[model samples]
Target: MDPVRRTPVVVTSALLTLLLTVLIVNLIQPVDAARAERTTAAGASSTSTVSVRRFPKAHHPSKSASSSSATKNQTKQQKPDPAATSAHPVDWLKPSQQVDYPDPAAHPGLSLEVSLQDQRVYVRDGSELLYTMYASTGMDDSTPRGSFRIQNERGDHFYNPREGMGARYYTSFLNHGVFLFHSVPTDSKGGYIKEEADMLGIRPGSHGCIRLTVPDARWIMQSVPTGTPVLVK
Candidate 1:
């Protein structure tokens, strides 16, 4: 072959090889870029899943904790007041003196009902309550619990020397002159005993007698007739 022909052929072959290498490099660059994009997307998705698993929503109190708090508030509201159970006196007078009594003659068929639990007397006409009176029945259930009738025995004042206590306006209800309705306890000198009188309508303190205020005993001694029904319990 001639030298010129060989040089042209070699040059053509070199140009063809360089063109093929450029085409292969272009195709491989696009495929590598696509693979890199897919790897970046997968890494971002895994990072997002980890972030969601690490942190949770804010905390809240459980149902039992809320219920316990509500129960404590209700218990505090339901507690009772200590002062409401007892009576308070007005000024210097006894608790019984603050009460108003009804006239005995106006209400027909009057009877007496005594409550040991409340330490009170209810004056009733049939089923109607006409008046309420503060009374001290007896200590340790000494006052008899049953129905009885008032006797014809009564007095302005009397003292039992053995017991060293006395009362005014005594009206016999049981055992003739043994158990009576009378004013609060008095000394031998006829002055009121402060300790026993203060407990009227609050607790039982009498010695098997129905103890009333001065005016209440006086009214009963004067107005209430003999054989009046009295129920004590």
Candidate 2:
């Protein structure tokens, strides 16, 4: 016979080995993907719970049921690939704004104070913050910075004389009684007298509502309503 070009045993075995390795990798890939997916699911669940508890329920679903239907279709039609889910981008997150504000003004009010020295509010009866907001209490005016109380109580505009300019903060929820803590005054949105402070953390000035930043005002409005005790010492 002519010089036989029979397949060499070594070459044949090498080809077989390569084929088997490829098959094994493909077989285990699904299991790896599943494990990764479980890990991702657990992390997402934990974050969702913390965020959801802090907020009110989403009232008033879409007027169009079709929108929800479309969402369902999108969810069911294609699941994300487990391996790529980690790399998938989620750019937006729910804003971590606070509640527990003095929203119920008509109902009654609480003594609200925003501390310039410690950046804290002191309510009469709570350990953890029952209600809070960033505020500026009588920056320019000698709005007594020590302790005071709801010397009187009423609802009025932010610039109302509010028991006089030099009043002290005390244990009352009046906007400007003995002390001043008003949501409207702290309204960065409503041209509510921006403080002289350069930073935006707490608006840094107040005729008094303790002059909280907008977010802090919102929180105070949500939590401490009228008649809530406040202690500014």
Candidate 2 accuracy as lDDT: 0.47
User: Which tens-of-lDDT digit does each residue in 18-79 have in candidate 1?
Assistant: 99999999999999999999999999999988887765532234566788899999998788
How far off is residue 36 in model 2, in Å?
73
Candidate 1: segments with Cα more than 4 A from true spot: 1-58, 62-71, 82-99
The superposed Cα distance between candidate 2 and the true structure at residue 104, in angstroms, equals: 10
Error of 2 at 25 (Å): 80
| Number of the top-ranking candidate, with lDDT as the measure | 1
TM-score of 1: 0.68
At residue 52, give the lDDT of candidate 1.
79
lDDT string for model 2 (1-233, tens) is 33454556668999999999999999899989998999899899989987897555353354456688998889976887677554221111111134443334433434544466654554433344344433445555535555444434434343344432321122235444545544423232334332332222333444444544444444444444444555654
Please give each candidate's TM-score. 0.68, 0.35
Estimate the overall C-alpha local distance difference test score of candidate 1: 0.85
